[model samples]
Target: MKLYKTFTSIIAFLLLTSCSVFEKNRSEQNELAYMKNIEDVAIEVSKKQYVNLLQPGDRLIILVSAQDQDVVKVFNQNYSATEQFRESSVPRGNIISNSQPINGPTYIIDGDGFIDFPVLGKIEAAGMSLDHLKQYITSSLKRYIKEPYVQARITNYRITVLGEVRNPGQFTIADGTATVLNAIGMAGDLTIYGKRDDILIVRNVNGLISKERIDLTDAGFIDSPYYFLKQGDIIYVTPNKTQERLAKRDPNSALYISIASIVVTIIALIVRK
Candidate 1:
């Protein structure tokens, strides 16, 4: 009976310690929202809204169209069908279609924030918005072609999400309106052991690089400055303590288990004696 009691105690202790291993460690802080209240219902979104602006090393798809087929022939690209054009219409960021072959002649922005556009020579396009650049191109093209209309978009608008996500890599924003949630979604959402409360977003502001921590579980973080993702933003979702321990190659866990077994064996021997 004494040996039976000793074995039962050892089993109970093992159960207690092993229970933490099976515990759901994901979304640990989801229930503890700092903004939570008994009367909490809805909150207003207060993120400062702004359009993405052109920057150095950014790729743009500049397309010029008019009623005149001759003008289209000189400027239009073969991105679409109808091969009466000199260059492609719009550039696909990282999309390569060997079937149709997405190829184009691009105007790379120089170090001084200028692109050597046809007829315009060096035009300042680094800081111009998409709409503003379209307007600027349209006005300049009026001298060469009547009824000049321009279509411009940033093709290299991409963000990266890494660490503790289902899928971590670079993703392109087709419309340039990607949000933090969108980036997380593209990464196949965070892993089961991911720390939802502490997410890091690294961004480049003008010439300065910055890092911001955001908590998805908190309602107030929705209206934060880092809510909206900008071009070249990199998001990193931190792992919880359980995940950290699992990732670590420490032998301390086996050591503890071995110690517990040794203690159990000593108790069994004492009880048998």
Candidate 2:
């Protein structure tokens, strides 16, 4: 009777340990599963789209094109076709001979939020959207070229994602606009251990830094201002409690399991004897 009780106790202990290995402390909330069994539910779409404004230390690619390429050549000093003339004291109207196209033009905004154009001189760019800046430049060129086309874009638009994700790193946004979900997807999505109900985002707009926490499990997060991420945004996926606990005791778990297995085998041997 004593041997039987000892065997039963060992079996119960082994069962508990094995079950603990697979036990997870996940939250009760479901992931992005809120819109179910509801009829005719519609959210008012926001008219405002997130636009990235120009800021200091921003690199830009401004290209001016026209029907008459030769007439517009003087205005495009930064263009590869006319880049060689910038170093030389060549007259603006006089085109340089045998100029080879090598590299694209890049305009860096100074600390004072201004860029010196080839002929327009210094112009305020910070606090202005890309479309606004393009309009300002195009309006200025009306005196020089008829139907002037100005193309402007921020070249260094980027965002970073970190923690509890498959891949965490800074991702460059080619289209100049991206959502929080898009940024997360770029980082290879959050891990199973990541907290879906609480996502953190750090944003910097016009020198003011702010932090916002969002819940991915709720559909209402789609209507939040942070749904569309801006330039220089940082996303961090927080780890769940289960992950934290596992991380703290993961190294010792193997040791504990090995010791338990040895003790169980020894007990079996003693019982057989």
| Steric collisions counted per model | 2, 0
* lDDT score, candidate 2, position 208: 89
- After superposition, which runs of candidate 1 have C-alpha atoms over 4 Å from their true positions? 1-20, 24-48, 76-104, 205-207, 249-273
lDDT of 1 by residue, 1-273 (tens): 866686878867876766655454424534333335313313344334567667777666666778886775566543443211212223233321122322334555677888767766778988887678879888888888989877665567778889988878887664565678767777788876677778999999777999999877667676777888888899999888767776686747756876887788677777777
Whole-model alpha-carbon lDDT for candidate 2: 0.71
lDDT by residue for model 2 over 153-190, one digit each (tens)? 56677788898888888876544667787777767778
Candidate 2 Cα outliers beyond 4 Å, as residue runs: 1-16, 25-48, 79-103, 205-208, 251-273
Q: Alpha carbon lDDT of residue 15, candidate 1?
A: 64
Score residue 39 of candidate 2 by CA lDDT.
Answer: 33
